[model samples]
Target: PGVTRDRRYGMVDWPGWRFRIVDTGGLDPSAHGILGAMRTQTLRAVEEADVLVLVVDAAEGLTGVDRDVVALLRRSGKPVVLAVNKVDSAQRESALAEVFALGFEDVFAVSAGHGRGMGELLDRVVELLGPTARATSDADADADSVDADSEQADPTGEKSEVVSSGAAADANEDPVTDLALDGEAGDDDDAADADDHADGDDADNDNGHVAGNATDVDTAAAEAAEIKRFRRPEGPIRIAFVGKPNVGKSSLVNRLLGEDRVLVHDMPGTTRDPIDTPFSVGGKDFVLVDTAGLRRRRSVDTLTEAVAGKMARDQLARCDVAVLVIDAAGGATVEDAKIAGMIEESGRGAILILNKKDKVPKSQINSKIDETKEVLSFLSWAPILLTSAVTGAGVAELPIAAARVFEQASRRISTGEVNRFLEGILADKPPPAGPNGRHVRLYFATQAQICPPTFVFSANHPTAVPVSYRRFLSNQIRQAYGFQGTPIRIVLREHRKKRKSAPPERN
Candidate 1:
């Protein structure tokens, strides 16, 4: 009875064992209306879990949330196995050092997508599970089959209050959102989870995994974790579902996740805070963030709504992609474009969701899509998918399309390749002569950064570069690199050859 829509618990079948994983929806407790309820459920998960799998994004590295969780796991007195998920390849293995800084006794760098390192992670978990696993299940025999393990005896109504007040304070300093699971059990993974779970053939039990040792909590260790945690997430892309109020953002999230983990209502602000849920599709890990819908800035007068709106925007900035949901029945509006523009300004990959298809006639779907696309032309780079969250139509492809877009955003090209591509552009159409009658001589180009790949072009006449030409260069770069669902940024800068100063005489 403790479980609610805010938290959903489920079991997974390994080769020899099964474990119940609880997904919780965490909201800010200070504004404890719904969040307080979520906190209660999360505490229940802690009390029940024999061994907590503290999953940290290996691609995103160890974060402050990881440190806070370490503090929580320690307080709970529960055995914990650190799962540094999304370590797709060995190149990312080096970042695992900082995860050990949290004082965790055992750590496993794994790819939850590829199922790499899972066997060992699960092996150690089986070890901790011990005899307690059988007893937990047998005791909850009359209870829901799904939560048999998760709903273990609440013997010590409270467990010696392991979470110290200080630890709670520190952990709450930057609390992680407790969003829940990926898909429904018994439902075929191929049909239910966007048809994207890795094939059994692709999953390898071995990736040379071993129990990692904890490191000393020295200043250097903390600083190193800080540096790695803040680095741009590489493998498991983060996608945010954002749009105007009552546009089916939460419904779409539930449809894709194959469960009602988030509360969906006709009320405008049903979702008051952002919740981050980790899921996998096609050997690719991703964080699906569901955010509260945005209202017009002028209309958002209440302090509460304002904070929620700001947090939604913050979630957008933290993500690698943003899926803007539009209601086909309501049609595209100015506010929808504004929301998309916000995603564009953040330089995140965008996907347009034309939801509520069941409510719209099949004859009018095309016209509606065309009108919406025309209205939100600013987000033309974003791919549009028509769907009915009610019946789960076309939702299966969201994650696949999003992963493709995230790839383009994170795409990198060699400097030589960039220069060669630029040469073709220059040859196709020569630069317009500057009004000063000086011939514009462009030197070379180099890619500056990615996640919305940016390129910097060095040239003598930076001021002479027109908006039209800049657009042309962006179009050409996208064309050359095949950046279909992502935006490309190009900058023109003055390249003044520096005069060599005479070397100072040495003593």
Candidate 2:
């Protein structure tokens, strides 16, 4: 097993025992700060362990650092075992003698590579285990308890009704939770109360630690699902590829994955469903959705094409970035522009992928680019890249650009930053005075949360801040902060004290 280090201490499981392993991580005992922390963690692990196993390399021989580790182990006054690994040949047997000088008399020689003397090594391990070894009968007892628990609980008995009901107070203002905890309920009355609680009619958020508590449980379950979750790609950038019939979506996907994972074919509408495959670029995870090519209903001559088109539209809804794949050699078409409009309407980040660039002439490329811009001028902001998935030309850079856009999509300005930006913008273009003689004073603002970061701005006469001015502010925020692909929700709330201080005015 690979060594796992948390702080300075690490741990591993041996048969019938938990070995608290420690890694010094190359800290000089004479050094300060880090060395002191390492020593502290090492001493803590040694104090807790029944048997301390000091592993040494047989081929490399002992070093000065190993001496320091041995000294630390000896000072602990605990049982120590020396495991001299990689002594496969007789010539290396002499190397073990140098390790013996450390004064660990109970040294075992073994070869991890050739599996030599493993049986004898195991016997020594058994002897070291000694008193902490669990009796065979106790193993049977654990199995019986597990079997009983499994039968009594739900098949997915992770949270069970008892555990959930115990925290009902968190969800709603139910007295039964407190009563159960206090053991104040009568047996007959408790059942009736629990039945009412199970009805799920009330909406309460009493469990204050719900989010924190459920993380470990939910993380383990998600890992069990075999879908690895990591940071949303480096820059929160996202790019999607979409096109009309027979455009190389699958071929592009296969190239992106660096394998023949997606099935590619020459036939039009080959992909019937949208498939999402994720990979990392610049320490960020980018999910590439290989969607079916779409076509307008008037242009679609077959039933199969219609199904593929619907699938493509469904994929667009969940995407942050979109790439409109155009067949460059096949020439620019009006249908491609229509598909590009759909991406813009989705409010997703957009990119234009001009595929088959190798075959197109340089002069024609500019004309094609101009043609595309003329047709899809609505997406004037999105970048267009010339790529060939087959040749792997310009394919690598697309994922990075996609990740950059995604990061911009998820970008949220800090409260301080937002207010500062707001101040500067106002200094340049102040909110116009209201018709009712109320001056619209925009005060502090903060990012309420994300998923498309919401901004809450406190101001005097929030109603006086016109819709046009709000849009102006939103645009300023996006321009300064680069929330290019994200839809911003601008909220104008009257200053809390001002709203609260006004006495009830007669309506």
Q: What TM-score would every model get versus the actual structure? A: 0.58, 0.46
Clashes of each: 2, 17
List, residue by residue over 1-507, the lDDT tens digit for candidate 1.
111224444555555455555544432223244445455546655665666766666666755545665676678787877777678788789888887777678888877577788889767876877764443345345232333332211222211111111111221111122211112123243123222221322222122111011111111122222221222633457788999889999899878877655677776777765766667778887767788889998998677688779988998777888999999998899999888888888888889999999999889998998999899987777899998899999998999999889878767665446655666677667567777776665555555556677776656677898778888888888777787777877777665443358999999
Return the top candidate by lDDT. 1
- The Cα error of candidate 1 at residue 240, in Å, is 0.6
Residue pairs of candidate 1 with colliding backbone atoms: 24-178, 196-282
Residue 21 in candidate 2 has what lDDT?
30
Using TM-score, give the best candidate's number: 1
User: What is the overall TM-score of model 2 with all chains considered together?
Assistant: 0.46
Worst 10 residues of 2 by lDDT: 160-169
